[model samples]
Target chain A: MTATDTHRTIEAIFRIERARLIARLVRMVRDVGLAEELAQDAFLTALSEWPRTGVPANPGAWLTATAKRRAIDLLRRDRMLARKHAEIGRDLSEEDDAGIAAIEAAMDDDVGDELLGLIFTACHPILSPDARVALTLRLIGGLTTDEIARAYLTSEATIAQRIVRAKKTLGKAGLSFEVPRGRERQERLSSVLEAVYLIFNEGYAATSGANLTRPALCAEAQRLGRILAGLAPDEPEVFGLLSLMEIQASRLAARIGPDGMPIPLTEQNRARWDRLLIRRGLSALERAEALGGADGPYALQAALAACHARANRVEATDWRRIAGLYDALRRVMPSPVVDLNRAVAHCMAFGPDAGLALLEELERNDDLRNYALLPAARGDFLLRAGCSAEAKLQFERAAALSRNEQERAFLLGRAKACSV
Target chain B: MRVMVFVKATEDSEAGVMPTTELFEAMGRFNEELIKAGVLLSGDGLKPSSQGKRVAFDGPSRTVIDGPFAETRELVAGYWVWEVKDIAEAVEWVKRCPNPMFGPSEIEIRPFYEMADFGDVVTPEIAEQFDRLREKTPAR
Candidate 1:
């Protein structure tokens, strides 16, 4: 093979193997940062040797063996600096096969467990939300700092600092590189899921950007969700989160118009929806349901997305079933956002009056004053209820509040279309 | 299962620039690989959207819009219909493809709707009609 071809192959293989390699090394070295450094060293070694020697038969094992040796060498240097083991002869013969075997054994031990541990460590609550996202993408998603920065539309230096600081914070906290058990496990898992969901949401609707959505970020989050589901197969919530992301991501293509304007769900061409992702999502939903997670927060949300996916057209959507899901979801994970959605679902199932009452109730809360969607939902219901002039005003309000350029344009277009 | 792989229009493609000889040779090798693996059903590259036309419908009236389409991102330069096992396998194969344009390009993989996806909505008569159409089409 050509040199460029070998380099590309090595790069692809390293992207796939880096996370597991670092996870295993972290288990031995007890340092996330150091483990990543060792993993990179192994990659550099591959870059230099693989072109001349040809790729290793088992490149992952070769990389792991290299990283393990680096760890032992570091340990040997530490022991010599301490000089406390002089009587015990801290100097080990470099040809010691048993010592190498011990390191290799630890590197291969419980990979799944080590991966889960790495995930939990990266998403540890000690770090801020941005730090958690950067660190999680760096370690779990196997994304480079440059890629992470591009995904977030930020400077690479900023992302690099976030990852470095996050690793230091994790080390300073003396966090164990082991998955917590029982309630602790559940809580940590929730934190991990929340970070993943947050990334997906940001991607689904960029908080403030010229574009309506960032498809790359949405794809990244879905990839992360799928990876999490593979690692924690038995965990119903993992499947729940995966199901929700897949179903929602399926709609991403149809959600934006050819002119880059936001296309509301009812108006989107259902034919453009990704059927494969929907199929994957429905199977994931089935798995979550089979595991008795029908009422779990993510499961319930997935059920809502499923309702849309199962429908052949907007008019055929099972709004009543969706409203029922929202009611159940409200009980489990009560939020103004869920309530607003429930209200909108009520409008579809019942009438605009039912939804308007709920919206009025929501308006009394000070928290949702700047939320553009609240007014947008109200405008939708008002338009459906034959209050076109009132709907126009609400659309204008929504357009004024929206930070997204495409969404603002779409809302303003709605306002312009309202009857005089 | 079938996936319609869209090779998105790049500046090189939209500007009517042909691919390099190396890229054409690489793509030929790739297509041969796909055919050998029994993955590729049909594939073709199209001229720029300027050579295309769009028919818009308003009620029963037809309005034909001439291209070049303003939105370059929405334009397709080529397409591949591949008979793959699933999305994952399709993605795996697409990842191995050489760049289709002279510069950077994107290929989007979208699955075709099987009659089964419609579930009970597609009646037996419709299924038979679709089956007949499938039989009439060229075999993969």
Candidate 2:
């Protein structure tokens, strides 16, 4: 291969190995920022050396070996004491300083657990949610600060500051590099899953970005979710989150019209939906359910999406089942969004009046006062109830409240049609 | 995107030789790594062409051909369907796989198509829809 080809190949190898390398590095160096820098140093070494070394047969292992060696050298230089090796790993201190740190010989097969530890660390609750998101993408997703900045539509310097602060926070915290057991595991895993899901939603339906959807972000989140599922295969919520993302991402192709208008689920071309993703999602849901997590918040949501996925057409959707799932979901998640979705499901399963009754109850509260969806959904139920004038007023209110240009236009069009 | 990863047939694989227990364990570890990376969608080994059949097609005719076809190196001993960011990612992952054959073997990666790939043939109107899902969550 040409030098350029070799460089690209090395880059690909680094992307795959970076996480595992840093995960292992943090366990030894005991600092997230220092470990990441050491990992980058190893990557630079590969770029300069791999083209001449012709890329090893097992490049991933070679990179890991190199990163560990570099990390040990850095520690030796900083500590100026070989005895500190007990904390770094004593087996390595016994070896000739010149020899590599295959040092943690016992950890050769335990990289998986180390990686899970890294995930938990990056998403630790101590950091702000934004900091956690930034750190996770940096340390685990193998993305540069600039890339994360562009992905989230923030300035590169801001992202850099967030990551630097996050690493310092983690450094001060001196968190253990092991997956917590029992209740702690459950809580930490949720943080990891939440961070991942947040990434997906930002991509799927970005709340702040100029573009409506950032497909790259969704793809990244999905990949993260899938990887998390593999790491913690026994965690039903991991699979549950995976299933939810896959099923939702499958609709991405059919979610928008050619004219840049958002396509609601009922009007999307069913044939356009990605069957492969749907199949992957359904199987993931099955895995989650098989693990007895059918009632988990994410699993319940996945079950709700599955009801629509199984239908070939809008009329064929299992509305009653969806309504029931929403009921169950509301019980666990109990948020304004879930309640609004539950209202829609009730409308779909029963009649317009039933939906209006729920909407009336919701309107009496201040929680959803500025939520455009409340007015939009109420307009739909009113229109179906033959209250066109009232529905038109609601639609106009919804259109005014919406920040999305396309959605605002769509809502206004609905309002205009109400006069007919 | 999705790609088909073909583990080319080798002399031992063509002879219906089974992999040793050590090889099996190594391969299992490699597969587990792929799963953990979320690159593997599906994968399987074929029962050698000796147990398979092929049909050749002509203008309107078809002829059945028996197994153990020639060009052994051209035949696939196993394959994996992987979901990856690009062919580059696929190549890196493939490099990590254990030798599928008892002896030296080659592997190939080829990405397949989605409906969007045939843009001209499909609807030209459906363009850039990937960037148009309205924000569902309020800004944090």
Candidate 3:
């Protein structure tokens, strides 16, 4: 075939097979850094030979075979590294073709466990959050450092350094390449989920930027969530997190305005919401519920979002149920943010006066004094309660406190509308 | 199962340039092959991103933003929803298709989550409800 065609094929093959190849290699070598190098070496070999030799029937197997051979050769050549050689030098006596076939055969076995191990290793809590993100995307997401950097809107050098540091930390810590057992496994899983959700939240609402959202980050996080959900199907929280993200993401299309400002839920056009994502989210929520995680923190959040997703219009929303959910969430995972949301839900379910009372209480609290949303919510309630002058002042406060330019502009616009 | 194959937009597509006749004919033949193989469920191309708009959100408020979105890499020029046995089978078919763009392009294949993929979480009642929903709207 043509040169470009061959290149595209090889690239696609590498994207599809890299995770499995590296996972298996990591299993053998017990070093993520070495495993990655071996996997890349295999891809380099394919780039050089596949164009001329034609694509193999099973390219993944071919790549794995090549990587396994290279790994063995590297280990054998390192005469001083007796421990490294001893650790990986297993059944290496077979000659060329037989050896390749044996390694390929081994790759077909226990890929699931190997991949799970790789994921846990990448997301080990010992590494810093930044390092975990970089490593997870590189190893499990099958993304290059450049791709990870581009996705996060950071410099390639920064991401590269983060990854190198992560691998070095993993090596120094001597983390095992196996999914931990029992409670430890759950803890590791939480770390993995946290990293994914943190990435999604940053994309969903950037902490500080001209734009309200970064769609690529949301997409990447969701992609990683899906992969995790598939890997740990029995984990109720995996489904919970996936459901939550899916439903929240459905609103992405309706969350921004023509002026590049943030849009509140009440004003968003329901028709613009992505129905497919809502459906997916609902199905995932159902799965979470069936798996006995309906009250789980993420699942509860999913239910809250579902309350909105199910409504055809803002007026049709089940405000009372949403309020009730907030109450439940408060009991289970009582955070200031949850309490703030609960206050709004109470107002929506009761009246503007009721919400105003809660906001007034929250206002006296020092913890939420700097939170822009607290003021924003208070302003909305006051405006609805016919205290427009007071609402105007609150909106101005929110605008000043907000870091995101789009959000500040939105709040300032609210302030202007209430000025009269 | 069904997979959505997204044809990523090239610079030409983002600029609203139409595919050349040769490329169009080549894609047509490719689609015909898929059709003959009973793999092609549906296919369509999208207009340029310039015609699109984004609605930004902050709680209950929304703001609309007109597009010629800065990120061309995120744009899709076309998509095909194909029924395939699995992702590997889908990849095999994609590998045989002619280039969909004059310049370098990408096709991302994502599987639609089948009810079976959800395992026992999809109870019989839920499965029945899903079946009814599918009957109401067959596209899924």
Candidate 4:
């Protein structure tokens, strides 16, 4: 291969292996910032060596071995300093040989566990959401600070600052590089999942950006979710989260109009929904069910999305099944969002009157007072109930409450329709 | 992005030929890889054109056309819908697909247009808003 081709190949291989290397390094160094520095040192070493050497047979192991040696060398030097050794060496002792042996043994431990531990550490609840996002993208996704900045359309300096502060915060917290167990594990895992989903949504919808969606961010989150699922294959919630993301992502195309307006699922052209993502989602849902995660928060949501996916047309949708799922979802994860969605399912499954009854209760709930969808949904039910005047008022309110330009336009359009 | 992959029909497929056991197994393995990678959304093989019909529309009139359609090489013998990071990734996956026909065959990848594929509508203004929001909100 040409020098340039070799360079690109090394870059690709490093992107895939850097996380594993840092993950292993973090275990040894006990500091995320130091582990990343060591990992980059290995990458730089590879860049200098690989072109002339024409790449190794197993480059991942090669880079990893190189990084491990760097970690060990750094630890040894820190021990000589004594001051630097006080922090990391507290876990071991001044005996360099024994400490090196333990470090080597850990370096040889199951890589999956190490990778999982890395993800949890990056997404620990101690970090701010922004810090978690930046750290997760940097450590878990192996993206550069500049790349993360461009992805979020923030200044490179801002991203650089975020990364620096995140690392310092993590160091201050002194979080372990080992995956937590029992209740701690579940809570940490959810934090990890939440961070991943936040990234996905920000990419999928660009909550506060000029961009409606950044497909790259969504794809990146999907990669993270896939990696998480692989690392923790036994965690049904992981599969459930993956399933929900896959299914929702399938609608990325059909969910929007060529004019850049958001399209509701009922009005979307179902033919545009990606069949492969839906199939993958369904099978994942099956996996979740098989793993007894059928009632998982994400699993139930996936099941609800699956209801729409399984139908060829909106009329054919099994509304009753969806309502049943929302009921179960509400029972387990009671939220105004779930309750509002339950009302929607009831409207579709039963009659507008039944939906109106539910909406009546939701209206008194302060949590949803400013939520546009509640009024929009109410308008939908009222319109169906042949109360167009009230429906028009509700749609107008919904349109006023909506912050999105396209959604407001759509809601106003609905209000206009109600007038006729 | 979502992409549609078409496995163009070969002469063998046009004759309603079935895949050999080995070929079928190989294709199955390839499909398993796609599914497990969460790339393959849904896909299926098609019957020969002899079993198909088409309805052509022009203005207010419609014409019912029956099989077997001409241009067998242009016919689709199978297709898959996949969600991929990009078209290049889809290309890599397709390159790994086992030959669909007993002989040489062709696979085509077409990515579904996203909102970004439309005009440059995504503005930097909203991103600035997001930055402001991020600064105001503490970590959740």
TM-score of chain A of each: 0.89, 0.89, 0.87, 0.92
TM-score of 1: 0.71
- Candidates in order have lDDT scores of 0.82, 0.84, 0.80, 0.82
> Mind giving the per-residue lDDT tens digits that candidate 2 earns over A1-420?
887788778888887888998888878767888888888888899888878878887776777778877766665665547466456654545454533344465237488998989999999989888998889888888878888988888899999999999988988987987888999999888899899999998888843334643677888888889899889999999999999999999888788766665687888876677777888899999999999999999999899888888887688889999989988998889888888888998998998988888888888878678889999999999998899999999999999999999789989999999998
* Weakest ten-residue segment in model 1 chain A by summed lDDT: A206-215
lDDT score, candidate 1, position A205: 82
Q: How many angstroms is residue A150 displaced in model 4 relative to the true structure, after the best TM-score fit?
A: 2.5
All DockQ scores:
0.03, 0.29, 0.03, 0.05
> Which of the numbered candidates is closest to the native, going by highest TM-score?
2
**TM-score of chain A, model number 4:** 0.92
Candidate 2 runs further than 4 Å off: A81-109, A206-213, A369-371, A387-390, A396-408, B10-18, B48-56, B60-72, B119-140
Q: Is candidate 2 or candidate 3 better by lDDT?
A: 2
**All candidates in order of TM-score, best leading:** 2, 4, 1, 3
lDDT (10s digit) by residue, model 4, range A184-239 = 89999999999998888878775333553366788788878877876777788888
**How much is A59 displaced in model 4, in angstroms?**
0.9
Q: Candidate 3 chain A — worst ten consecutive residues by lDDT sum?
A: A206-215
What TM-score do all the candidates reach, one by one?
0.71, 0.87, 0.71, 0.75
lDDT of 3 by residue, A1-420 (tens): 689877877886786677878989987777899999999999999999999899998787789889988876775556435546464655444444464465556567677677778888998999888888889878876777887887678899999999998998888987778879998988898898888888888788853335432566777677677767666778888888988998888787668765666678887766656667787788888999999998888889999999988887677889999999998998889888888888899988998888877777777888777999998999998898899999999999999999999789889999999977
Model 2 pairs whose backbones collide: none
- RMSD (Cα, Å) for all candidates, in order, is 13.6, 5.8, 14.6, 9.7
